[model samples]
Target: MSPRVKGAVLGLSAAALFGLSAPVAKLLLPSSTPLVLASLLYLGGGLGLAGLEALRRLRGSGASGREARLGRKDVPLLLGVILCGGVLGPVLMLVGLQRLSGVTSSLLLNLEGPFTILLALLVFGEHLGRAGALAAGFVMAGTAVLGFQEGELHGDVLGVLSIAGACLAWAVDNNLTQRLSLKDPLALVRTKALGSGVCTLVLAWLTGQPFPAAQVLGGALVLGFASYGLSIVLDAYALRLLGAAREAAYFATAPFVGALVAVPLLGERLRPLDLLAGALMAAGVVLLLRERHGHMHTHAALEHEHLHVHDAHHPHAHPPGTDPTEPHSHPHRHEPVTHEHPHVSDLHHRHKH
Candidate 1:
């Protein structure tokens, strides 16, 4: 399959899995405060991914899990993504959930799409064509649709602000994560999970949050594995294959996933606004699927370490008998070349338009 197609699928899958976490977590809230549960969720994700990494080594698979191991130079940026996305985002989101209903919180999380796209366009220099712009508009419109009746006149002001703040933090995290997208995604996932999980778990203790019951701990771990660990690994792949804006656009459907599931879980009545927002979010995703970015670009000679195969883009020589078709990692240099072809803002295609 095309890289973009694979990327979109991964992004959508991640978003869908994340949608399930909110309501299930709400069910577990009686066991502990939002802070402690948030910490446990992250801890679960970290430990789960770490175990997966261990299993990969034990089975001696392609080791794609370690294909693009983290390096010295990657430490600071990796930490940044962990702190912004893994630590701050989930904590603030749970805080908002404290005040808002589970379904409402899930729907409100739609804001992350537009926030991610806007940051991608303005800060990361990602190109946004007509389709992308329309998608962004629909997503932005959806964000407002839920707000009109969120808490009636009084409004859940603190809850909304907290969730919005978390969205912004994740938006920044998504853009920054582009820098590491080309690395081993599983490695990245485990690292972020461990880093954020450990940090938040410690913070929970320091802040005097008590440990939750076993069932609640289990829920947090399970949710964290699916929502944070696996979801984020997929997200990293999407960022690598598709540009941030398009991935964000596709991911906008996450709210719909949550809303649909919550109808039964939360016994949520289908509101008119819910239908309207779902339509808009769906339209946005469809438009993004049609997006295509291709143009003549130059590749400046550079060396980097990441898993790569001998595609037209990889014009470097390797030692005798090395299979070019098999993906491998090395500090290969790209000779300057100019050509026209379809591409996203992937590792080799981060050129200014």
Candidate 2:
């Protein structure tokens, strides 16, 4: 399949899985404090992915040499991802969820897309076209409408700020993860989940948060495995293929999914403003999805390793006895070339517009 198609599928799938998290988490909240629940959620995702990794290794299906492995140089970025995404993001989200309706909280999550895109463009050297800029504006406008209702903000102001803060933290995490997208995604996410999970778990214990009941714990773990674990792996792959800004555009759909699910699951009413916000955000995502960018660009010669098939980008000849029919990774060189094709800000296509 085409890289863009695969990236869109991955991003959408990630959205569906993660979209269920907010409402379900709200239902689980009554039984556990935000800190303790956040810890369990991360621990669940980490442990679940770890088991899958172990199973893959046992079955000899591991990508031992088929994908690039993270190295010392990736440590700082990985740490940033864990700190922002796994720890700060989840904690703040849960705290906000406590004081807000599930649907509103879900809709409010639309902010993450704009925040991520802004970071991608301004700080991470990614580019955005006219459609992308308009899409961002629409999304921000939707958030503003939801944020200020009936001539004032809805729900608790503190809760709104907390969720926005979570979005910002995850925005930073998204960009950092994009930088590390060249590594084995499963391995990268596993390390991130486990590391952040442990840190949050420690913080929960220190704060005297009680452990949840067995049933609640189990539910949380399962949810985390699907939402945080698998969803994250898919998102990492999308980032590699589509760049952070485009991936965020697709992922922005997640909040709408969550909002819709919340109406039935949480018995929440969809106020007119909620519907209005949803319409605006949905329009923005549609624009982003329809947008395309392609131009004549140059690729600098470089050496790197990542899972790849010998295609337009990698026309280099391999050594004798190398497996030629499957995607594999090793240190390789790219001879400089200039060409024109439709592309986003992927690793190879980061040239200035």
Indicate which candidate wins on TM-score: 1
Best by lDDT: 2
Q: Kindly report which residue stretches of model 1 are placed more than 4 angstroms away from their true locations once superposed.
A: 63-66, 87-111, 146-150, 153-164, 320-325
Question: What is the clash tally of candidate 1?
Answer: 0
Please give the distance, in angstroms, between residue 327's alpha carbon in candidate 2 and its true position after superposition: 1.0
Against the reference, the lDDT scores of all candidates come to: 0.78, 0.82
Candidate 2 regions exceeding 4 Å error are 62-65, 88-111, 143-166
Kindly give the number of clashing pairs for every candidate: 0, 0
1-353, model 1: which lDDT tens digit per residue? 88878988898898898777767787767657766776777777788888887888889776374376788999989988878986788778867877877656655776787888888878787878786798768866765675455443323889888888889888888888887887888888788778877877777788788897777688789889988788878887898888788777766666567777888898887789878988887787777677788888898787788887778878788888764546887777778889998887666776786
lDDT of 2 by residue, 124-185 (tens): 88998988789767766765565544433357998998899999999999999999998989
lDDT (Cα, 0-100) at 238 in candidate 1: 90
Candidate 1: clashing pairs of residues: none
